[model samples]
Target chain A: MALCNYYRKRKLMDNLVGWWIRLMVFLVVALPLFITASLLSKSWLILGHISLPELLFSSVWRPLAGEFGFWPFIISSLWVTFIGLSLTAPVCLLSAIFLTYYGSRRLLGFMQPIIDILAGIPSVIYGVWGILVIVPAVGKYLAPMLGYESPGFSIMAGGIVLSVMLIPFVLNILIEIFRTVQHDLLDASLSLGASKWQTIKHVVLRKSFAGMISAFGLGLSRAFGETIAVLMVVGNVVGVPENLFQPGYPLPALIANNYGEMLSIPMFDSALMFAALLLMVVVVVFNMISRRTIIYLESRQ
Target chain B: MAMETTKLSIQNLNLWFGKQKILNNINIDIPENKVTVILGPSGCGKTTLMKTMNRLVDLQGGARTSGKIILDGEDILNTRRDIALVRQKMGLLSQRPTPLPMSIFNNVAYGLRLKGIRGRKKLTPLVEKHLIEANLWDEVRDRLHDPASRLSIGQQQRLCLARGLAVDPEIILADEPTSALDPISASVIENQFFKLKENYTILLVTHIMRQARRIADKVVFMYLGEVIEQADVHEFFNNPKQKMTRDYLQGAFY
Candidate 1:
């Protein structure tokens, strides 16, 4: 009777544990779907008030006047993210290669903790640094050097700051990816009379192509949705920017800046929720595409 | 055998990794156009000694060596000597066949392109010739554009052999080339070496006594980072000068 009772208790414990694990897995898988559903339902109120094209393509964002077009904000977000990525990709890739192939072990060890610390710093702190350093440099020197006259807060300043923020994140991933290329592959190339630089270019870079794409994809998503640091330096002007030097406002800055006062304006809460929905959709689509590309590349190998 | 010309001469080679001696006072004369086998148990520094010839040991941190490795009457160990040129004249096959992350044809053509050869017309024939020389042409000619990783393990080794041969080296340094292959693949590589030794000097490293007897024209036995015996293959097996060599031949210990 004791053995029978022991078996019954063990079986009950196993089933309970199994159900708990299944619940956790279900919650994780459903999280994105739940978020999307809530965002869609909230944004539906604004969609009923205005046509989708008018809301998306119009540049005039007068909340009290009941006009909310997102064209300028969308364009500004794309420009800042593009400029940031263009600046970060080359430097991070080359630095990773150097660290893997040429940098001494002591140097790599010293650099790793520095990169980690940089990644750990909050975005608000980055915003403060951007205001103190990058904004002044752009206003005082860079604009005048290029024969332009303006206050420092502009798309270029925001891009510079965002690029700085992205360096550690992207660099960490690139270094890991480059290191994953097998050492024997390097030895094989070297033994074939290829120069070190040649081996890096042909073998290491070629092998890690998919990983590089994913790293850049992640960097793009992060830069696109960044709010505080970009808002501080981007001038937050409600207009389409013509050049890197022009002041403009992006989507995340829009949502973050107006969320407090959204309740007072007509249909403003729905508009801000719609902005959040747009941000979520774009990031999700980009991540899905990059993941598919990675799977394809791995399958080909 | 007629008077054999030395293709490579190692004189008083000593190597230390942070004060731990890995190779000590090694000397050998590797004859031209012959298969010379270096037989030893694991951790005997036979692989390290081979790496020193190609200067791959330089990649290891804190590895210091003092020696003269003369190849074709030139002291390759001289600091001013172009390491690329030294490596180009000698092809090395590692224990496992490592194909570059590229197509089969590109793997063979890579070394040729490094020498400044360009265009498909020029590369196509040379690639084909080397593949044929490595005895891999018939199997892979139709799938030259496929990724090299898709090939069987045996085929990959042959592709690596073709890649090495395409560099047009005078010497081939194979460090246990067949150790990772099946018996059929092993015999295939051995047969290729027998035919290849007529034109290029081959230095093979193996611990298998039967393999050494099958392919070696001359044998150099190593033990604990030192050369214990050097002789013709028959004499080295029949009458080893050292007790360790005799014991190793009789399978006393690996």
Candidate 2:
């Protein structure tokens, strides 16, 4: 009779634990989706009337005349993101590869903690640095060389600051992933008469391509969502930029510059919400694509 | 076997890893076009000796060496010799089969490509030839473009063998190559080694006495960072020179 009671109690505890695990898994996936869905629904009423193509492609966005074209801000966002990525990718990747494969022990030990500290720095500080240092340098030297006026508040400035901001984020992740490439694989490459460069190129980089892509995705997401540094330099102009030298307004900057006065205008709050929704979607899509690519590559392996 | 030319000669080789002696005054003359198996217990530095031949040992941090490793009348221990060039003359198979992250064809073609061989037409035949030589072409012929990692562990080992062969190395260094494989795969690798000995100098490291008996043409028995015996495979098994060799062969204690 006692043994039967013990068995019954054990079965009940197992059932309860299983239920708890199931609930936790469900919440992990569902919670973020639910919150984002609720936010999106809140903006749906006004967003329903505005054609997405107009918001995406049209350049003019005048609030008093009831014109709401978001092309300029969205395009600027994409422009700055691409510019930052283009600047940051090669530098961080090369640094990461060198540190992981060829750097001396003392150098590697010194650089790793420095990179960690860089990653932990606040965004607002980067903005201050850009204003006090980069802006003046560009205005005094780079702009004059390029035959441009001394405004210094341009897309190039934003991209330059953003790239510096993203270096540590991308490099730290890449170094770790590069380190995880199997030691035996490295030995195999070296033994096969491959030079250090060849080994890194054909083996280590190829093996970690998916992880690198994800790092890029994360960097892109951060660049897109970054507000303070970009707001300080992007000139706050809602227009299409002709070149890197021209001042422009990206989405995050637009939202930051407008969210305070959103309540005064009709449909303004909904439009800002829509912008937030678009930002969320773009980030989510980039992250999902990276995740799926990694999964696909892993499955192949 | 009147007299075989020494393909690689190690004289008074000593290695230290931060005050801990790993290889102590080792001396061995590896003959040309022969399968020389180094048999020893775990931690006997068999793998270390093989790696040292290919100059892969110095890659380890704090690994210090004092030795004269002469290959083809040149001292390979000299830093002036190109490491890539040194490694190119010797192919290595690690304990686990590590296929490069690429197609089966590319894995074999990697070394060839590094030597500036280009164009699909040129590469395809050489890849096929090496694959055939490694005895893996028939199984992988249909899936040449597929990822090399998709194959079984045994097949991967064969693929790695094919990759090593494509480099045209005169010497092949295999460190416990078949240790990770099943019996059938092990036999396949062993058979390849037997055939490959006619063209290439094969240096195999293994603790398995049965395997040493099966494939070794020349045997070098090592124990505790020292070589106890160097003899013909038949004589060594039938008549071991040293007490340690006898004890090791008798399965007295590993």
The regions of model 2 sitting more than 4 angstroms off are A1-12, A296-301
Cα error, residue B252 of model 2, in Å, equals: 3.2
Model 2 Cα lDDT, one tens digit per residue, A182-284: 9889888888788889899989999998899889989999999999998897777878888777788998888888887857787788788888888888889
Separate DockQ for every predicted complex: 0.74, 0.80
**How do the residues A1-301 of candidate 1 rate in per-residue lDDT, one tens digit apiece?**
9999999999999999999999999999999999999999998999998899998899888989989899999999989999889999999998999888899878899999999999999999999999999999988999889988758999989999999999999999999999899877887888889999999999999899999999999999999999999999999998888777889898999999989785988889999999999999899888989999988887666
Residue-wise lDDT of candidate 1 within B1-254, one digit each (tens)?
A: 79999999999999999989999899999999999999999999999999999998898888998989998888888758679878988898888999998999999999999888999999999999999999999999999999999999999999999999999999999999999999999999999999999999999999998999999999999999999999999999998889999899999998
Model 1 ranges off by over 4 Å = A1-14
Error of 1 at B54 (Å): 0.5
After TM-score superposition, the amount by which residue A118's alpha carbon in candidate 1 deviates from its true location, in angstroms, is 1.2
- DockQ-derived CAPRI band for the predicted complex in model 1: medium
Give the chain B TM-score for each candidate.
0.99, 0.98
| Model 2 / residue A175 / CA error / Å | 0.6
TM-score of chain B of 2: 0.98
Q: How close is chain A of candidate 2 to the true chain A, as a TM-score?
A: 0.91
At residue B251, give the lDDT of candidate 1.
91
